[model samples]
Structure formats: structure tokens, C-alpha cells
Target chain A: MGLSIPVGMAEVKASKTADDSLSALGLGSCIGVCVYDPRARVAGLAHVMLPDSAVIRATDRVVEGKFADTAVPALVQRVESLGARRADLRAAIAGGAQVFSFATSSPALAIGSRNAEAVVAALKTAGIPLLAQDCGGTVGRTVTLDVASGLVRVRVVGGEPVDLYRLG
Target chain B: MRDAGRPGATGSLSGDAGTGTRGILFMAFEAEGITELQLDALREVGNIGAGHAATALADLLGEEIDITVPTAGLRRTEEIAASPEAAEAMVVGVLFIVEGDAGGVIVYVFSEADARFLSDRLMGLEPGTTQQIDEMGCSMLGEVGNILSGSFVTALAEFTHLDFGLSPPNVAVDTLATILSEITVTAEALGELSLELDTHFVQQSGQLEGRFYYLMDRDSLGAILGALGMAG
Candidate 1:
């Protein structure tokens, strides 16, 4: 099923076989932070909307998949549910735009930036090396993760699509 | 001094309090840290956000949705700090984290019933489920928050020729007090502004409640307005 998932959302759709994991489109200023472990053939994606869970109310259910701090852990846990290991898993990050009106603040500290930093921090804290990153800037991005092939695509307007796995 | 629009036939909740020439105009004092221009920028930015949100809603629900342009209203922390409704209000807060070029989050809140109304329609569920609240329901709710908030932030970038980084939206279901407290404590970090918009759904009772908090110093707002060629 070719489905388009909007921002601040994630879906774990699977195909009949181990080769049919799903993919989501466009992630900008929003992170398309994904995790995959070859051994488990498992992959997970989160379109995070904030940096940390601290900003949310304790009773909110949407908190799990909403922030980078929490969502990253949740994605890792999800992949692990299918038998993926943190040590063997490779991570990729993309998209975070300063989507609001102009300001003098450093874009590096904006929510998008914070999310990227938080994701990186969370992965490192979990002892996982971030294999690749496509973060920052002023554009919206669409990300696709083909769980079966372990192929990931990051697309943005005015630029060529990029392969997150192959990038140095 | 007040210029009230013709009051809608539907009586105000206060009934007796809204009959004057000025309808119901609740003006919170100008935000000490927020400037008029920033509020305007936020308003225009909201239009863009709402437009994108409308499109997403149309796509998700397979129906036509229209959102009226946003109007800016700067309310004091005290004014909005109070719960507007007596019943337990189901509010979803979408915080668009902006970094690199800008900083802040757009806090969009809606009544739980309204959220379910939009969620049911978006998920293609039948009517009468508008009052249902669950995790599945929250996912749909998160989508609307993400689209509307993200688009609104994106509009700011377009108008100011600035780039922004965004964090994912923080979705929650809570009471007005809880939601207000969540925003209140962050007062030091944000230049808050409120924009209450009127949104229309194809076959559902319309929804209301929208607000934005730009985490920037007061001066930055003037600069943004100057960029838009508007007065501070």
C-alpha cells in the first residue's frame, strides 16, 4: 500500500513477508529519524514534532510519538520488539526547518535543531553510532524507508533526492 | 474603545454579558515580551499554517474543509491562564519546535469533542463517534496539529526569507488548567500571542481554539514585522 503519512505522525505498516515494511513521505523541520537492524530485518520511523517530552503534559497520550527524546526511544524499542539490537542497528536523521517567521535566534537551537541534537544524543546515549544525518536548513523534506531493502530516501524541494544509507 | 463584529445569533456562553454594542471582546493586555508586529507575523503565518492544515484535512478525510483567515489577538498570560469552559476540555497541544534560524512553538489547542469530530471525519469513521477518545483518536488528532502548526511555521519562513528548523508536534489530551499551566511556565522562553480562528468542517459542527507562542525576544518581533513591511 503506497500511503502518505503526514508530519508529527508515524505508522508501522508491514507487508506479509519480512521484505515488505512501509515508508512515509516528507519530513522537514520535522525529523525523519529512523532505525534499522539487518539481523532482525526490522525498521522503524518517527516523524517527531518536538525535542523532548518535558514540554508536554503528563496525561497526554500523543507524547510517546511526538517528541524526539521520547519518540526515538520508542522507535528503538519498536524495532527491538522484532528482535533488533541496539548495537547492530544503524540510524539516520533528516529534516528540521525553522518554519516560523524570521527571527534573530540561532536556528541551531530551534525545535528542529533541538530534535536533531536530541536524536543524536539519545542514540549516542544508547551507544548507537549515527550512521548518517541529513539535518537542518529551511526546507520541508519527505522521507521513505523501504524496510525490506533497508533503503531510505530523503526528498526536498529544489534539490535532488538523497540516499541516507550511502551518504558519508 | 471596541469595534465588535455583529454578534452571531448563537448567544454567548455568558448570555447576558454579550448583548452590548461591543459583543464579547476579551482583550488581554499586550504581551509584555510580545510586540504587535510579531503578533501580525504570527497571524499571517497562521493563515499559511491553516491553509496547509486545510489541505491535509481534505486529503485525510476525503472531503472539503475551509478555515477562515486567522485574526491576531494578544492576550495577557492571566487572561488565557483561566479555563474558558467548565466541562473537562480535551485539548491537544501542538508545539512546533523551531531552532536554527528561529525559535519557538505554536501551541494549538482544541476541545476533545472538536478533536474527535475532526478525527472521525479524517479517519472515515461514522458519526456519533465524535465523543470517543483514545490513542487511535489521538494519532489522527496529532496529524491535524502537525499539519496546521507546521504549515503556519513554514509561512513565517516564506514571508521573512528566513529558514527555520522545527521539532515534531507535542500532542496531548488534557484539561484547560493543565494546558494553560503547560504554556504558562514557559512564559520566560516565549513571546506568546493568541489567534482564535473559526474553522468549518464539511459535515461536522465547526471547531475553534488556536494560539501561537514564538520563543523570541520582544525586539525580534519588530524586526519580523519590519521585514514584512508592517509597523510595530
Candidate 2:
């Protein structure tokens, strides 16, 4: 049996051992970014809640893993610290769902799509290649990344687990 | 079979006096300085609203429904998400956005078993047998949410004398954590502290036990307090 580590809301975790798996559960509008280096058998996951931390004025206490812009870099650093090379890093993403659809005019309702865009942009800035992503639907998802095979699986309510991405 | 507890009996009110000077544009009010009296006032508002909602639900299901006194307070979005009561439970959430004078969101959460019970009861199907909610079941559940939410809003409006408009209810069946994460995301985006009101519901048949959470933004909270003569 593999060791399962849970990544809570606005949390990030990285593991280098092949028998370790990182999991983020109950992701609705929040996006989970997974980066893995197959060469080093290291995987990192961040559960990001918002698109941009810069837009928030609560500078006194900022959670880096909670925003797309800061979460991507922070996740990269975590993986790198575990002996994973940035040059060998590839990423896959999940979540970013609109669980409720009412009041389309409200800026908050569009946050799912905005978070996805922000994550893509941040990954580009970090020079990481995007391998695959499953996002933008009405259902919430729980995601797990297996460090042994670099396979990311997403599970939804009343649905079978689907293999969303694999890092080569 | 879980014993239900009254809301206000579980937690106490604590105030933070240092949040007065943050002065961020959208971060107007922090969860600080809320007095016990103010909490009691909010609790009264929730009690009245829950009474009305329970009455509506009882009428719809043709059963005796009981509701506990509501607990109201200021809490961080993360705290609500991390609560053990909601962590892994499978629930059906009915979410609505309230606009106008006091804007916020209201979420009615029912456990999967309870949701199916309500839907099955409404559809005249035998209880404890139907496992899945089809399209018709979904529509029935949505209507239940509409009635309960409308009644709750009406009672609050009457008590506070504040004009309020509600968007149509959006229903989603998922884990409680997922539903809560959506609320947390919206709350963080607005840079607003959440005014969390929680209520517990029970039915005579004992087939359903549900929880409802009402979250309001800072502006809306201020408006409500101002209307009740509790604003600083």
C-alpha cells in the first residue's frame, strides 16, 4: 500500500518517494495544480483557491498556495526542494468547476474560469510545459497524483475515476 | 439516528479589537468586536427565519419538521471549510445569491440520504428504496430549496425591514467540502469576512437531518446591523 498525504484547502505538499501519493479532496471552484518530475520520481500539488493574490488587499496575511499566481511558483519551489529539476518538470491541472450557476453578472461566479486562465498563465511564465488538464464543469472533483507512475486521477460524485493526465 | 443539538449552545462569541485600522478598500469589516448582544440579535433573526423555513418544509413534505435555534457569528471561510462536521459528508447543496440592499449567499445543505428522502417523499415514492435522483427528482429538490429559501428570506426581510431580492436556486449534489470551497472562493475574491449562520433540521419520521448555512459579505453584514441599530 502507498502512503496517502492529504492537501487541505490552500495547502501544498511535495513527495519524492515512489510509494507516496498526494491528494486534494472536494475541490469545487478551487483548482489543484500538480507538477511531477518523472526522472526524480517527485510530485507536488497545490490547492489554489483564487485567480490572483495581487487583487486582494489583505496583504497582512497572504496564503501563497491559495492563489494561482503565487501557488504555481510555490509548488515549483517545493518540488525543486525535493531534488526535482525544474527543467524536467511537467504539469497537469484539475478542478476549477462552477458548482453553482446563478447571477452570472457577479464577478465571483466567473472565478472558476479565471482561476484556470491564471494557472495556465503562471505555468507559462515559469516555463513549464502543460501536459493535460480537466476543468470547467458543473461537478466538483477529488484529485490524486501517484508519484510512482506520474498519473493523475480525478474522481467525481457518482462517477468512475478518470485518468486525467500522465507525465512522461 | 444522530442526536441534533441547538446551534448557539455550541460556541461563544469572541471579539478582535485590532481590525479597526486595516482600511483595505473591500476589506471593510473584520470578524472582530462582535459583542455577545450583537450575536444574540443575529441569533434572533436566524430563529425567526428558521421557524418560517421549517413551517414551509413541513407543509411541503406533509410531516412534522423541527428546527433548532440558529447560531450566527463572524468566521473565516477556511474555518468553515475545515470544520469536522462537514468534512467528508455527501450532501446536496442549494445555493442562491441575494442582491439589492443587503447582498450575500444562502446555502441549504441536505445529506444524500436526507435529500433522497425528501425527494422520494415529495414524488410519492416509497422511502428508503430509491437510491438515485433522476431529472425529475432534481427538479423536485430544487423546488423544495426554492420554498425553504424564500420563506427564510421573507422572515428576515420582515424583521430587518431591508429590501432583498433572490436569484434562482442552483442545486448541486457533492461532498460538503466541495460545496464549502465554492463559498470560500467567492468570499476570498470579495475580500470579505463571512457572517455564518447555521441551523439544524429534523423531521418526525427521522429520515432526514440537514444543515443550512447562510453567508453574508461585509457590506451586507453592515447593512443588516445598521438596519437593526447595532452598527458602530
Candidate 3:
């Protein structure tokens, strides 16, 4: 079974009675960040939709999954609550594509580029080591992380296929 | 139920003015066979739902948003596909399943870019998160469409005095060809007389998109128009 959170939403690492665990589904300009603490046998997933939340005005609510500013903190808090130690966590990120077919533009500030950068910064700040990542292409992806087996399956519409274990 | 004596009238009390017309009216980005009044009613209904959706996004983003429903008229799917706007924009579509023997399908299409914006914001994560655009995206989009369609469904049930249930909305994200192809399939079974409307949501970038279509059989269209007193 899989737990699918909307973009900008976070789910802390947990192991339930159910043997199979997975986090599935994500969409445009959104990134799914997965963290696994092998020591704790816990895995967490955060689906981010934007670069930062502070940029959002005080009245809007639809961008919960789009920003790094909001997503990182929320994720940290969730995983921490699950009794996962900060020192042992490792991360893998996927999705974040410039899906539009427009002429080549600067990638420096594009939302996709920015989101990946922000996620990396957040990981560094938290002192988490980078484990793996498959990002920054035009195609969309559905990443399924299986906590029981530590397998991350990446699927795309039209792109080179990758085995689930490749990301781990 | 109102004025059952009217020879052409169906006994249902739901009154929709300016609704009936057997012929199809074509335009860019939308097509359907329901009465004009039904289309109008549907647009108003979309306004309400878009407001709710915008609110959901605004709340998550911590900002204020406004979603407006524009004036709509009948049009063809090809016309909508050919429109320059359709080429570069993200389209958000919601299909409505209404209750009653005469009830049929209703469709809503929006700009593709606007759809990306909506998805980016609605999911409340990163703007450029999912580049794959696969079934998961469809499910995410379906959730988005559900909100807008829910509003229309609520309005229809109340105004038509009929109990209509909405099947989970099937959401699709794609380019002009994808949008046109899907609409073509739906139109074949539903018939065509698409009435179009524009809906603008006020937010960070002031997202705007067009919404339209009301699908129904001949008698249903006439009854709705006659009820609304818009029949000419």
C-alpha cells in the first residue's frame, strides 16, 4: 500500500503492521523528497510544489506542496516526531521538470531549478548526507518508496527507464 | 412540476431561462449540447467552485485569491483547439454526470499553463515538482477538477430540483492535441453544443482560465430554457 500526499504536504517516516510501504504520485513543478533512516527502519516523504512559502501572501492556501521554505521545516518536524534521529537520515529526490516546450531559457531561476537547489540547501542545513537523486528533465515522474524493502521505483511517460533500486 | 399544463413542458419544476436550442454552437476551447441557460447556470456554478478552490490554494499559500466566471456561449471543440490560446495554455477539464433520464454530460476546459499553475499551487508544494505528467498527475488533476465540478453539481441539484450525483471527476493534463482528442471522444457519446465561459482566479499571478460545456438531449435543453424564461 502507498500513501499519496498532495504537493507541499509531508509524511514522516513510519513502519506500520503492514509489510509493504510506499509513497506514490506527484505533479508539475513539484518534488518528492524521501528520507530513510536505515538505523531506525523509518522512511519519510515530502512532496514540495514551490521554491519558498514566505513568497506566498498571507491569504492563499493552495501552495502547501510547492515551496521549500514551508516544506522542509514541516518534513523535519514530522520525521522528528516519528523518533527518527536527525544524524542518521539520508535523502533521495525526484521530479522537477521544465515540462513546457518553450525556447530554452535560463535554468538558474526557473522554478524547477530553484526547488532542487532549495531542497539541497535544506538537507545540508539539517546535516543530512545526500544519498541519490533523479531530477531536472521535462518528463513527469511517479516515485514509489517502499520502506520495508528500501526500494524507490521511478516511472515516466517517455524516458529512459530506471530500476527501483537504482535510486537507493 | 411548475405549469404542467404547458404542452411542451416536462413536469419537473426546475426552471432555466434562455436554455433551449437543438443546434450546436461552436467556439474555441469548449463544446457541448445542453441549453444556453443550462450553460449559464453551469458557469455561475463554476464561479462558486473556483472561489472555493482559490480559497484552498490561498489558504495554503497564505494569500488572498479571487476566481471569476466569465460570459459564455456555445462553440465547437475544433474551434477551441484552433484558438491560439489553446496551443500554449494548460487545460483543466471536469465532466459532470447529472441525474434524471434526460441528463447528460457537461465539460469544462481551461488553459494548460493555467492548469499547471493550478496544479502547482493546489498541491501546495514546489511549482515545478512533477515533470512526468502521467496518471498520478491525472489523479492530482482529478482532485482539482473535483472541487470546481463539485460546486457546479451542488448548484445543479438545487436549481433543477433534481438529485444529481457526481462521479469522481476524471482529470487530464496535456497539450492542444491531447485536449482535443479527449473532448472528441466525450462529444461523440454526449453530442455537441459547447457553451464557453472564462473564469479568472485572483491570486499571486492572477490565474485566468476558460470554463464551459453543458451536455444534454433535446428535450432536456428545451425544458431548461423554458423554465428559465429565456426562450425566444
Question: Highest TM-score among the candidates is held by which one?
Answer: 2
Tens-digit per-residue lDDT, B168-212, candidate 2: 877777788888787667656665655877667777667877777
Instruction: Write the residue-wise lDDT of candidate 2 on A16-114 in tens digits.
Output: 888888998888888889999999989999999888887756534577888899999999999999999999999999988888775456775788889
Mind giving the per-residue lDDT tens digits that candidate 3 earns over B63-179?
A: 654443332334433233324334334455555544453354555565655556656766775876645555665566566556655655555555545555555564555444334
Interface RMSD of 2: 1.8
Residue-level error in angstroms, candidate 1, position A64: 1.4
Instruction: Give the residue spans of candidate 1 off by over 4 A.
Output: A1-21, A24-26, A57-62, A104-109, A158-160, A166-168, B1-232
Cα lDDT of model 1 by residue, B1-232, tens digit: 1222222212111221112111122222244554544544555443444455555555655544444322234433333343324313445544555554445455666666667667666777786566766777766666676675566556667767766676565555554444443443233234332333333223223443344344443344555566677644
Candidate 1, residue B58: the lDDT equals 52
Candidate 1 lDDT, A116-160, residue by residue in tens: 888788778777678878888755566766666667787664357
Evaluate every candidate with DockQ and list the scores: 0.02, 0.62, 0.01
Output the better candidate (2/3) by lDDT. 2
DockQ of 1: 0.02
Question: What tens digits encode model 3's per-residue C-alpha lDDT throughout A1-168?
Answer: 454332222233344212545553433345678776666666667766556556544543333334566666666666677776777777788866554332224342255667788888878887777778878875556666666555666766433446545222
Q: How much is the lDDT of residue A16 in candidate 3?
A: 25
